[model samples]
Target chain A: MVIINGEEQNAAGLTVAEVLARGDYNAARVAVEKNGLLVPKREFGGAVVSDGDVLEIVAFFGGG
Target chain B: MIPAKEEMLAALKERIGGDLLEKFQSSAAAVCGLGGLGSNIAVSLARAGVGRLFLYDFDDVDVTNLNRQQYKASQIGMSKADALRENLLEIAPYTEIISQKVKITEDNALPLLKDADVICEAFDKAESKAMLCNLVLEKLPEKYLVAASGLSGLGTGNSILTRRVSERFYICGDGESDVDTCGTLFAPRVCLCASHQALAALRILAGLYDV
Candidate 1:
């Protein structure tokens, strides 16, 4: 099980892309971080998730 | 008798306390995007006697920006950076205002933001904000970043707030509100958000980083 956005989930061996898709997050709008290191948007497809890995997804909204 | 410039500065120091005032006078901030949020943040920081400000904007002062942004009708044709510089100088003449008329991107953000103690993210687009925040957090980890993400139409003033994302990142506004849902942009709410950003920056500069 891996932690995504602080929620526990069974995501071992899943790529970042699969994890994002499972969570229904819009790929184009969010910046993802894995264990405090940024996973550049382009490499999401190849970065795999491991047990207990922490992921933080931040979505930006326009205003200021 | 007319007071000397030093006398005036001394008066401010007496009001804010010598140590705090000195911190404000020594700290530098880089404000990206001289729109409503950026311009207002710059204005407040300048008025508070912040020592140096680096202003960036690629757009000219459009007539449409007057509704919320800090610009005058007479200054419509001028570049946003130049017009904002004029505004800041009028408030705090001693402040070092470095205005640049160019777009900031991932490729150039580091060099542009490297010197400032704080980076103010006031871009109007989500993509632009994300790009700057990501690049800054990844590359320039030492600098504190204050970003505003909401404050659309005339919603309740209390809904807008300042939130700390992490040790180095802080965001102002309701975090979830936007122009799409709030309808249109207005001055009061937008300025409120700008104040939050400015206050957060000042706190960071003064070493009040508990938030």
Candidate 2:
């Protein structure tokens, strides 16, 4: 079980795009980093999420 | 025996001194929104003895605002700026308040922020937040603006994040979550962000923190 936003997520063999689609988040405004490595938005569909992976997604609002 | 403003000044003589207090009292800050975050920030600055607080919020307090906003149920139909001014005076009667019950647009942004040494951008909507940010950055080149974003949710640990965005600007709060997702905010988080903002204002006023 992987944790998406601290919630236990069932991502046994799912890609990052599938995970985000399941979570109902916009990929455009969010930056996904896995284990401190930046995951490009274009690769989300192909990038596979592994177990015990520490992922941080940062979203930006309209700000200065 | 009684610590009036003068005596309070005398007591803080060694720590802050009369000269600094005088400067603090003469300096002005404009808070652009009187919503949840703005309300808390305004009250905290007023209590901290910031000389003049120019508050702007076009909306009247609705019943929905009682959840996390600083106003009471009795103030539901009142203008947010007026209600905030009244609330702030309860804590420090001598703190001067300038209530502007109007929205911050490009036309009026300069006038409202012209004399402001520090500006607290507390607008909730992203469009308004961006508008104010650009307005202050482009129009008021010298003023220090502390803008808040990403303050949402229930956890205290995730509620406060302060970063200096530019030479004259600082950003505080979670940086991701929003009011729509988190619903109403708790005082703990709001206070944390407000305290951070007030500290930034103080440092700017004291010439300790230059952007």
Among these predictions, the greatest DockQ belongs to 1
CAPRI class assigned to model 2: incorrect
**DockQ each:** 0.60, 0.09
Per-residue lDDT of B94-195 in model 2, one digit per residue for the tens?
788999899889887898889889999887776677667656766676898887777656666555777665467777777876767666566676667767
Each candidate's TM vs. the true structure? 0.89, 0.72
Candidate 1 residue lDDT tens string, B147-175 = 88878877799998887666788878876
- Candidate 1 lDDT over residue span A1-64, tens digit each: 8887678999999998998898786676567778877788888899999998888777677776
Model 1 gets an lDDT of 0.86
lDDT of 2 at A53: 70
Pairs that clash in candidate 1: none
All candidates' lDDT scores? 0.86, 0.75
Q: Could you tell me the TM-score of candidate 2? A: 0.72
Over A1-64, each residue of candidate 2 has an lDDT whose tens digit, in order, gives 7766456677857887887787776665455556545566668899888888755554445321
